[model samples]
Target: MRVVSLHSPAKVSGISTAGARLSRLPPPHEPWTPLLIGRALTDEIVRDTPLHDAPGLALCAWPADMSPVGQVLLVRERLRELGARVVIPNDLYHGFVAAALDHHRGVRVGAWLHAEHHDGDELFERCAPISDAWRCVSERGLARALRVGAGLDIPPAGEICPACVEVPPACAAPSVDGPLRLVYAGRLEKHVKRVMDLALLADELDARGVSFTLWVAGDGPARLDLARAMDTHIRAGRVSLLGPVAQHDMPALLTSADTLVLVSLSEGMPTTVMEAFACGRIACVTAGCGGAVPLIEHSGVGVVVPTGDMRAMAAHLARFAADR
Candidate 1:
């Protein structure tokens, strides 16, 4: 199957990594064609790639900053031209439905939802008119979708399509020989990822007399706060901010640390968490991270703390220090 993937231009940097991993899937022979937007002339890259062929399928992902109505129109037009089906978020489909007073473009519509808010049932009921199939990444996601679809009177056309881990194998695991090392490997932001929780954990660890090292990867608005917090730690030789490292250098960073950490306030199954797991490195995650916690717990691959709970975080750090 030829699948056309829609994602933001920011993620285009990792296309080679994503494509390489997808190509290795023992499969129904499905390959991906990534369609990136939100960058300068990204259409050129899309047109030049081998994925522009006809008779393919389209998969829209990363619901952030998405305009479902505009995306649906684009998807509909592209599907008609390529003879491909359109798969997108239920939210996107709802937008399409609103603008589609003229009727949907008659292409099969699938909802690929990974997470939901408490009021998702009400939100999804709003899309009964346009969705044909539904896919959720986890059992919780499936339940939420079902409840919402049922409430909306949009009986699903089939069973759920579970989300899979798309993380690539880290070439090596970080060696745990020196100071207790903890690394955060995703974008550093406040609204979504609870990066502040990590900062607090560092403070807690220091106050508790725990000797360790903290390495932060990626960059964002939180850099200044992280910098202020790291000064004392850096002076004490306890923390180091590597800034935004390239995606390809991630495995090396991952393998360099004894453990990985993320205190996200919300997530749709973070790719970084999966990469940490795949590297066989233990992780320290917050409850705000959905779905993947169960996998982490089931695999005995890491520790989970209540969202924003620095006390619990400190305790976990103590454990890691003891074991180390």
Candidate 2:
């Protein structure tokens, strides 16, 4: 028996890393035959691939970005070639495991949804027919997934170990003279992360006499538009675009930051927010943002605001800066 976790290389940055942190296992003392089909998993490319002696526990990850059907079928065939029966695929962000489910209906499939979805976007529901079990990263997300009339697995958020997270040193409270160091990491896609909103919020903060410098990490097609939105701030040394910092380098950048801010339209349990908490920095996140809401609320690690309310966010940041 082997465990094969499948995911796309495209997801290596944001989603895959979070999933790995939640479910990755340690390597065994004995050597085993770990099959390789495509690029390695995001976080632990070598050590934590989950090819244990117990096939049920082995994690085989593959990507389904460009051609979902082809990739899914390829994974199914690969698993069959290896004589594996049970395969668990994380179906949170990508939604590409259905083709694999279709071809391998007899296999015990463990599927999961990473966040709450639209009524029309029943991702977990679509795969339920072929799945042996269903789970979610957060209980709230699981409840919402079940509301769509689908069986969802609700696990404790603490199941993800904090010690497993790799982060930088904790940041200290800001002083009156020092500008507030803000950060927005992860993919720059506008659909989910809504990064353009950060540019607008920067302008508002500057107008309100808030001294702050925002450092945006990661890259995407929206890079040009984000630059256009922050034209003034960029010139005035208020916003810096640290294009695509390697995952290993993220800890240093995040540790220097006073606050980790994400104003996404939607979110799952954002690893970046948890990354901030691990680094002992504050998180100013949007309210009702899937799994991240509870992490921030329960830990008292940061503040939560209404989605799209730039004014309230700016006020909150300004007040936070003043109090510090």
Candidate 3:
């Protein structure tokens, strides 16, 4: 079967990384293709390697100003050209396009929930009616879908398709001798990710006299502002901004850090936490980080603090640092 997975640009974010991995790891008998929309990144790791060489993947740059109807038509034509029998839209824009294609006799559409927040609710309401199936990145996301389905009078049928990562044979344990090494890998955005809170967390940690080093990987609109906010830390070598590390390099990055930190205001299921687990590293996340909270709590993988509570996060990290 030919499957087309539609997603946003092939950037250094979780969705883009997951889409790239899916393109390369399809069933032997099924030719799964990732139809990435928008301009491609020129990053050495992202644009030059896996995405370019991955089999059955197609990259296309569409005009950003294209009308919604036009985008849908373009996607429909692309699907026909690719002979895609199954369409999975990983984002809301492509979800709408996939929903429109549900009328096609030979094609099946699946609505994917990547978050458990307001946007997830919106996606299900707008696309679930026409979607032949529902898929979510985490159990929390799947539950959210069922709840939304109940409200929308849609059937309760969806599967949890958690984010994936290739586990290495062995990962080096975090060193017990130096300053606590923490890494945050994701888009530096304020709204959902609340990346600005990192600045606050740094301040709290400094106030507590916690010895630590934070490495932030990934870039977004808030990058400049976050850099400004952490200027003192950056100058003091307490924080470093490693912009947009590639998916392939993530395991090494995670293995190097004692703990992966995510202080997002909200999340569906962060792929970084899964990668951290695969690399034998724990996580310190906010309670708003959907599925990650329960996973951390149940597994004792790391710590979970209330949303926006930098003081609590600082306290937990301080304990880890002191204990280590």
Clashing pairs in 3: 218-244
lDDT of 2 by residue, 218-292 (tens): 777688999999999999999998876655566777778888898987765677777777677889988756678
List, residue by residue over 1-324, the lDDT tens digit for candidate 1.
233344442322222234334434565666544443332334554443323222232333324565656655555555445443443433334323422332354445455564556544554566545556555655666666676666455645455444334445435645546678888876667767767677788889988888788898766678788788677777887877787665556767777777888887765556667777666678888877766677787888888888889889888878788776
Q: After superposition, how far is residue 210 of candidate 3 from its true place, in Å?
A: 1.5
User: Model 2 residue 70 lDDT?
Assistant: 65
C-alpha root-mean-square deviation, each candidate: 5.7, 6.2, 2.5
What ranking emerges by lDDT with the best candidate at the front? 3, 2, 1
- Clash-forming residue pairs, model 1: 173-255, 174-255, 174-256, 194-264, 194-265
Of 1 and 3, the candidate ranking higher by TM-score: 3
What's the TM-score of each model vs. the native?
0.74, 0.76, 0.92
Deviation in angstroms for 300 in model 3?
Answer: 1.0
Best by lDDT: 3
The whole-model C-alpha lDDT of candidate 3 against the native structure comes to 0.79
Give the winner by TM-score. 3
Estimate, for each residue in 124-210, the C-alpha lDDT of model 3 and write its tens digit.
887887777777877777877777777575545756777667898899979897888999999889999999999999999999998
Candidate lDDT scores, in order, read 0.60, 0.64, 0.79
Residue 44 C-alpha lDDT in model 3: 42
The candidate with the higher TM-score, 2 or 3, is: 3
